[model samples]
Structures are given as structure tokens and as C-alpha cells.
Target: MRRSLPVDAAPPVAVGRGEAYENMRCDVCGSGERDEELLLCDGCDRGRHIFCLRPIAARVPTGPWFCPACAPRSKPVKRFPMTQTKIIDFFRIQKGAEDVEAEKCGIFQDVKKRRKRPLVMHKKRRRILPYVPTEDKVQRLKQMASLATAMTSATMKFSNELTYMPGMAGRSSNQARLEEGGMQILPKEDKETIELCRTMQKRGECPPLLVVFDSREGFTVQADADIKDMTFIAEYTGDVDFLENRVNDDCDSIMTLLLTEDPSKRLVICPDKRGNISRFINGINNHTLDGKKKQNIKCVRYDIDGESHVLLVACRDIACGEKLYYDYNGYEHEYPTHHFI
Candidate 1:
């Protein structure tokens, strides 16, 4: 079902740049035309036009109106899990591929000629080569539980990181994207942040982060210490698949991966089955008061070697105990926040 649109086909919806409208628009219909009838949700503060509501209302309510999902005592009706493995077998991972770790860590061009080396060949780095995870068993389990909780509402298997199923892109094929002009090498500035993250992952050094359950947001990630701006937090790991195929996919945590000029080559990351803390990080309802301020973590994409990796970086200095939030729709404003957790 998922395949890229032909080049001559109708234009697709914009994916990035989720900018809200100038006037408060209806969250249900995504329109600002009917100004007077639009009512703001008391809970999330998103506007909803009266006509968009079921059984169309004649006039706006008095004071403190809430959406159906945000109504008092209203409960979330969770749906069946989208765990069918057979439905995603349209793509296949390239065979005899390079190991994934090397693809993630390696980004150097081969040197044809060698220069004379100094007697002391040692090099220096700001952070250690590999990050070491805390040895505490309780903390490790806590991290695992956070990942597990991402899909707990729908009953899904837990994954600490992204997993490549048989039909997903293989390391070698992903690496070939550079030659095909579909991806670029991580810039020097971008490389530093990602390298730090990789070192932490290599040494199993867990970030000073934790996943905590929020009655309103299901599960959310938080900073355990004061984190600096541009500090790499975690990569959005998941099953990489074509976007066209997932048009009807029931997974809620799917993220856009690579969007190339060629419509047939679009890719998306489905984290329902396997992902880390990034999967648990909730999206900001931009219509709320904290919608803009609540986003402490900025999601960034990088092309390391030939593979694409999505990283969650702090947009600014984060104090201890602050929860993390980001714009799920990037800049497009397409992803909806209609269903409250």
C-alpha cells in the first residue's frame, strides 16, 4: 500500500515546518474560517469550531468548555496493537551488508597518501571515547521500562534501540545513499554532537535522563541533571520503512525519516516495536500555553556515512527535573493533537 507518489502525480502534503496559523484555528477541522463558533479546549487550550463537533452545535457554550477527549471522566479508548510483522515485508534489507555499528560510527574519507607522524601519536577528545552506563541494576531496569511503556498502552514488544527487520533498509544500502546523492555527510559541527552520543552509546553510558509516566501524556522523558544546549540526548531509533506503504499503518509513533526529491524513495521510521527513550517523548500540543515553551528538546536529523539518524538535541540549557517535549510534525503542522493521552 505504501509507495512513493510518481513525480507527475499530485503534490503531497508538506512534512516539515509545523507552523500554527495566525488566528486560533479549529483543531478538529484545521480551519480558521469560522471564527465565532470556535471554542477553546479548557484542558489543552486548542480551539475547536462548533460545526466540527458531533451533532453540530448552534452556539458556543458559556464558559470552560472541553473537547470530548478532554472532557472530565472521559477515558481513552485504546485500539488493537499494529504488531502484524507480515504486513511490512514489501521492502528487503540488502544482503552481505556492513555491520550497523561501523555505518553509524564511521564517516571518514580514505587517505590515498600518508603523512609523517609525530613521535607521540596520541590524540585528545573533549569527552571520553566510550560512555559507560551506570552499573546500578535498578536504573538499568528503569530505562528499559521507559522504552517498554512507549507501546504499553497498545501492548507492544520493547526495544532499547532501532532494529532492522528483514524488509528494512540494510546498512550497506543505506550507506550507498551518499553516492546516489540522496544523503550528505554529517557536517563538522553536527558530527561533534552525534559523536558524543555515539561514544556514550558505545560505552553504555546512559544519559542523565529518565522516563516517567504522566497522567496526561502517557509517558514522557525528563532531564535528571542540568543539560547544556546542543547536548546529544538520544537517537530516534525504529524500523526504517517506506512512507507510501504505511499510509494506513495504525502505529501512532511513526516518524518521518528521509524525504528525497524522488517521490518513490521516501522513508519513514516506525518505532512501535523497537525504540529507545525518544519514542516515549511526547509531542507538544502547540495550541496550549506551554506548546512552544514545553519543547526543550529539538529533534535533528543527520546523515552519518550513508545512514540517516534522527537525534534529539537540547535546544537550550535544561534544568534538572524538567520534562522534555518536541514538535512531532516538525514544521508542517500536519500531525494532529486531537486525541489527548
Candidate 2:
């Protein structure tokens, strides 16, 4: 009295050195039916339904078929630790690598013709500068297009700065709310560095950065050039919304913007609809012993122009090709990062 499901014709088996059918069950659907429809990953040795793939492979792959999670990725992030005193100094904008001599920093050895003046920030609005790729025009266009495509998966539009959404306090009107939450105003040097990044965009320059897709970590940012410690990496930007409104929000990347005495008045940054490169950064695993060691970037919140703004700053010197990572839940530990590497 039961009808059987129609099975597609058996396709050619792939030549892979994976484990011989441990359970022969589809890891995605937990189905044992149609043994021909399952393909074991060469790396993880897990079976996946052919139809469960994004592109839906017609037949078994030629050599290896690694699942999305098991694919080999390159994002060798540094494991530098920032001391508590240094973090307090960062909040106050006390000292930075901009004060050191670039030539003597030993980051780039080819800086013999540069001037000795310290990098000074200007007074301007915060913005995300366009990344100028050190490649030909065609390649630049390709990289830009690739970046756009990578971020557009969630229907996100490229934004250089934060967008004020409805139900959120106006930017300039949030001073009292932020102050009520023990938030301090952004210091002058830190404020100017933000403008410097925005100004650099106007001059067709940017902080040397690159975005790469990793299997285990998803999309991650890497330094395109040698960078000094305490450099402003980028701002964690998106639509600003009140915490009370987004309590049940399904967004996974929402960052806490402001925490107030009243739990209902807190603000969170949601980068789902619009965002910048900061949206792609991965978080550190604070639950493990090696967690703090993997974070090279620091996520700090400051009241900029009476509005809560989050900035990612480098805690130590970063070499080119090194991936960037920060603590999602710093000392407060709001979010869970046990699953993260």
C-alpha cells in the first residue's frame, strides 16, 4: 500500500581514497536509501546526498569531494595577546605605533625615502574606505567584483559606514543613553584616525586588507601589507537598532553596540541588510586556553559623535598574509564562541 521513491540512474563512482562506507548514511538527511546517491568526502569521510549540495552534483566527483566544512582553507591568523593595561590604554587612546618611526619598526625594509613625520589623523566623519588592490586594473575590477559577490549572498549592499535604522535613537541624540551605559566619548586621536581612514578613501587609498573565504571560518580578513600595532583596522558597522526590538532577531552576526543600566535600552549592530568588510571577520574562541592567543584585533566600543560605534584595532604588529581575528565576547562574554576556532 506504500509507494517507493523514484531513484535516479546510478552514476559513475568517483575515484577517491576515502574510508569505505562507515555507516553509508547521508550525513545531511540521515538516509540509508539509495546508496548510489551518497558521496563520501575524501577528507572527512562523511557521506552527503548528491541533491543536498548547492550545485547538486550530477555524478560522483572525478577525484575528491570534500564537504564545505572539511575543505582545506588558508587563514593563518596570529596568536598575540593584549595585556589588560594595554587594553585600558587603547580605550583612552594613550599611545600607538603611529608615534614610532616606521623605518625602524622593521616591518617594511623598503621605506628608505619616506618622511619621518608621525601619522596624524584628521577631524572628519567615520567611513569605510575603498580597498585599493595592488594589482592591474582588470584584476582590481575582478577582486572588487569578487568581494561584492561574496558579500551579496545575504542580499547585502556595500556600505562604507553605519546606517541608522528606525526605532533607533538618532546619532547625535544618543549621548545621554550611551553615558548612562558607562560609555566614554572617543578620544581625539582615535577620532581622527577614523577620519584618516575615510579621508584615505577620498584619496583613492586604503588600509592594506584582503578578504578570503575559509571553509572552517567562513569569510575572513587578512592583512595585505605589514601593519604596525594599534592601527585602526576597520569599524564594525551595520544597521543600528535597539536591543529591545531585536531580542528575537534571527541574525547571527549582530554585535552589541551599547549596554545600558536598563537592559531594554541596549543597542546592537545588525549587518544583515548592509555592511562592510567588518561583517566578514571571524571571532576567537574564548572558552579554550588558546582562545586569547589567536586574537590579534581588538573590538572596542566608543561614543563617536554621540552615537555608539565599534572599531577593530590591531593589538600587535601584523605581518602581511596574516589573518585577522578578534574576541567576540571580550571580558563581558555576552556571545558564545565555543564552536569557533
Candidate 3:
């Protein structure tokens, strides 16, 4: 017979064998080892049901395995609560009303001193025109002259005065003679244009002229005369035949006047061939370091005598000799600067 085992020679306690001694329940499913197959965590000896494993191991892991909580690689995320003092410091709340009152008083004193000084109007500065290559300038001038000639020819051919006489199917004899002779009697001056011109003459200034110059991006409009903000820059008046035919997203150079919200009532104005100084007003895209916009003008639609007109209104005080700009995309903040020049 074998000798009796010594008291210290008894086997060490078997981990997760029975609930009587180990009393181990799965951390995941709360099932004891006697009720189901369990994996005892090698690190903390916590029980986890075999079926409750996230990936459901086919068999016990070859080596020692840990329960989800006791895994060496698992980390618990810690979050700290925001305190009232932290918020106050972030917002820089003032602690004293006396400091604020003193600051206000200083501002008031500065304003009073400024009011006592003699009022002096700021002199308008001169805008430096961009230099263009001689060849490019000549080509552009030739193109402009050609376009003007074509426009003049078309105006003479379809003279507005040459209308059908009473009980006649064709133009009046005098109109026919004027057309056949190729004589273009200048149409009566537009009252609006004439009145604006007179106003400029009274101010000892001539009407502003459009000058195209090569800039960093491309050719752009520059005014020869200083134009005041909110003043009538120029008027674009023409027959419906002169408007653009195609309406689409690709056409940014054209301004479409929405007579009504309905698409059928929309009027598209294309100033590509003919327009006033307003056409030269570029869209605002460049911004200051703080994202402040430099746009000083806006396009407003006006209805006069059953016709639609686009007027450039001064949105803010524009300095003289500054480049004119407006929000072309309507929404100033959401404009796609990449699409603009």
C-alpha cells in the first residue's frame, strides 16, 4: 500500500472546478462552472462562459486566457467633470464693475476730443491702373471696336422708329428710306442717362469710362473717374433681344433679374457685349485675416415701366479709388471662391 500523503503534500486548490469551493460565476453570463463551460481568467481568476466570448472561441485558447475585464490590453476610459471655475476662466468674466465704468469713460473722452477737431473731408485717392502688354491691349481694342461696329449695324437695321404704318403690312416709306440709305440717326437719348450725365457735368466731372487692364487673375474693369457709393454708376437699357439665351449655373458673368419667382417670368441680363460701369464691379472673394468681407455693393432689382433693371446699391461706406465688389452668389459666406476670379 502507498504511504499516507503528508498534510502539506495535498494538491493545490484547482481554480474554477466547482462552485462549492471556487464559487466562481462567469463575469459575462453569470453562469457557474458547474452549470456551463467556463474560462477562468489567468490574471484575476474571474469566470467567463465559453459561449459568451465575443468571438466564441472554437476551443479553449491554447495558453492562459483572461476575462474581458482582466485583459492586460483592455483599458478603461476616464473622464473628468467640468467645474464652474474652469468655465468662468475660459470666458474671462469681469470681477469688478469699476474697471468697466472707467473704460467707458475713457472712450467717451476720446469721442469728445474728436468732435472738437475741425471736420475735414478725406481726399479721394487715385487708383493705379494695371499695365497691360502692348500686343494684348491692341488685340482687345480691335475686338471692342469690331463689337461696337456690329452693334451699330444691328441697331440701324432694326430701328425702333421704323414701325408699320396704319393699314400697312411693312415699314413706313420714310423708315424704309432711312434703312436703305444706311443712315443711323442716333436714337433719342435715354432720359435716365441724360439726367445722370447732366448731374455729373454739374459736379465738374465727366461720366466714368470702362478701362480693361491686365491684373493678377485676368482682365478686369477699372473706372477712369472717381465714383461715389450709392450714386448711379451707370444704367443698362436695351431691348429684350440683347439678353442672354442660355440660363445655367455655368454663367456667372450674367445677372438674371427675377421678375417673379416663376421661371417663365425670369429675365437674364448678359453684359458680355454691352453693359455699363456696373458690369466691371467684380465679386468679393478676398477677405481680411479675420474673415471680414470687403464687399461694399449689392445688386438690387427694380421694376420701371414693365421692365426690370438691376441697380448697384451701396451696402457700406466705400472708400474712393477702392475696387468695387458685390456678393455674386447672394450668400456672402457660402460663396465658392474657387469659381470666382
Candidate 4:
């Protein structure tokens, strides 16, 4: 038969931090002690030491039980794998140092003291140094400007003389003669260099668009959409804050979709297969977008993930040959994980 404890009845063996543990004295074994021992609970929160309880060990299951005297100990939780362990250790050490420093200062007390002083130094007697202008001599300045103007006129005349028709705009037979005299203008074309320049111009510092397929048979396409071609059109997208902060991580928070005008009446769906569509979208909005929905826009395509899902974008309607894109957001990410393809 199952049993339930009386609501008003005291527990058989309470072994942690609670009103019963707090009020009940450690010395009296029923009355609580005035100076409760500070102990960390299994969850790493503030807890009371062990020796305060009546029986000293817990049999009660309902309450958060941690001995006030000593930190509650449970079997160590499994740790991350070796690579992750190293990363954790590195960060933990750095954080531990910060904690130690913070404890010493006693929570912004040092900050207050440091902040009391003026950030910029003030001078009692502000001495004025006499300014010596570069163009103090009017005649010299005029002479220099006249020389510059004359030189520019001469160069323009020479350049006009060198101008040629379509295929050979800047190239001239005189270029080889000038090269021997240690002068070089535009470089001779190398096929590899020309191709590299073209690639760089096309990519334009915008990251390559990533399309991940969990299963091999997932439908994928590389095509841009005109306004009419897009089933669902979300205009004016991308996070201003993300751009401002230079955060380019895959998991970075983004601007929420401000307007969800389903012109095509396409069903807005979530990537999560198990949860309700609205709830999943809410979760993605709140956590991923940082809850700011402004001019940023996004579109949802039902079958993209083999489930209903939304895709984020950049503002402009891409050209026919352009790559499809999604914002790869991140918040305080590590190096290797945030690597570009």
C-alpha cells in the first residue's frame, strides 16, 4: 500500500535546510540554533550545516535537505568528455580567480572607491601654449598650392595623352620602359589572381550561407527569389544590434521577425516536431532572438526540416543566382565552434 505523510506532522528524519531544520535548535535537538553553519547544498546554493538535525541524516524525501554545518555531498555528477573538460577547466580557473577577487573586494565596494575619483585629471592652472601654424607664412602657402596645382595639371595632360580605346584602356607600350625605370602601374593579369579577385568581390565579407541536412535525402536547392516567387515574403530583416556588436556566432541572438504577413497563407511552423508550433516559435523567439521584434523579418517554410520551420534572412531580395542565407547567431562563443566553413 502507498503512504502519505500528514501535512501538519513533522518529518521522521529531516536532514536539510528547511523551516523545521531552521527553527528547531541543534543543541536542544528540537529548537533551531542561532548561528547556523553555512554549507553549500548539492545544487551549489546556500545551505545549512549537517549537525543541526535531530537524527543527523535524512529519511525525508520531499524537502531540499542539506546540512547547514557542512556542504551536502552526493556522488559527483558525470563530467564532459576530455576536450570539453579541458575547456571547462580553463574557464573555471579564470572564473575562480574572478570570484576570489570579488569576494576580497566585497561586491562593488572597490568599484565604488575607484569610481569616486575623477576619470580625467584636472589642472589647477590651465596653461595656454602659443599655437604655431604650419601655414604662418602666407606667401609660402600660396607658392606650395600653386606648385601642386601646376603639377596636377601636368599629370592630367600626360594621363590624357596615354588614354586609349576599349580593350587597352590603361596599358601602353611605354609601361615596359617605365617598369625598367622602377615604376609600376596596373599589374599584368594572372588567371589565378583574376579568379581570386572575382571570388572576393562576390563574397563581399558576408559569410557563406550554411544549409545543414540531418538526413541524406533532405531536399535542398540553391536559388534566389523575386518578390512574387517567394511563397512567404518577410521584408527588412537582420539584427541591428548583432551588427552593432560584431557578434557573428551561429547561436547569437538575432532581431525577431517584426511582421509575419503570410501573403501566400503559408502555415508558420516550428522546427520542433514534438511541441506545439506556436510554443516552439515562442521559445525560438524568446531565446534565439533575444525577444526584440522590430523591422527584422523572417519567413517560414513548412517542409524545410521535414517539419514546419521558419528561416531568418538578410533584408534585400536576393538575385536569381545568389546564395540562400540564414543568420548564424552566437552569444559569447568559443573559437573552434564558431569557425567559418
lDDT of 4 by residue, 177-288 (tens): 2222222222222222222322321222111221112122111122222322222222222211112222222221232211123222111111111111111111112223
Lowest summed-lDDT stretch of 10 residues in model 3?
Answer: 126-135
TM-score of 1: 0.55
lDDT of 1 at 305: 60
Q: TM-score of model 2 relative to the true fold?
A: 0.60
Instruction: Give lDDT: candidate 3, residue 49.
Output: 60
Q: Assess each prediction's global lDDT (C-alpha) against the native.
A: 0.58, 0.62, 0.41, 0.26
Better of 2 and 4 by lDDT: 2
Q: Could you tell me the C-alpha RMSD of candidate 3 in Å?
A: 32.1
The reply for model 2, stretches above 4 Å from the true place, is 1-143, 167-173
On a 0 to 100 scale, what is the lDDT of residue 20 in model 1?
41
Q: How accurate is candidate 1 locally (lDDT)?
A: 0.58
Which stretch of 10 consecutive residues in model 1 shows the poorest summed lDDT?
84-93
Task: Kindly list the per-residue Cα lDDT of model 1 for residues 115-197, writing each as its tens digit.
Answer: 23343657732221122233564564455444444455545554445566887665443432632345545666456545645
Error of 1 at 170 (Å): 4.7
Best by TM-score: 2
TM-score against truth, every candidate: 0.55, 0.60, 0.36, 0.17
Clashes of 2: 1
Query: Where does candidate 3 stray beyond 4 Å?
Result: 1-194, 197-206, 223-226, 236-245, 248-251, 286-292, 331-336, 339-341
Best by lDDT: 2
Cα lDDT of candidate 2 equals 0.62
Model 4 stretches astray by more than 4 angstroms: 1-16, 20-43, 47-291, 294-299, 304-310, 315-341
TM match of model 4 to true structure: 0.17
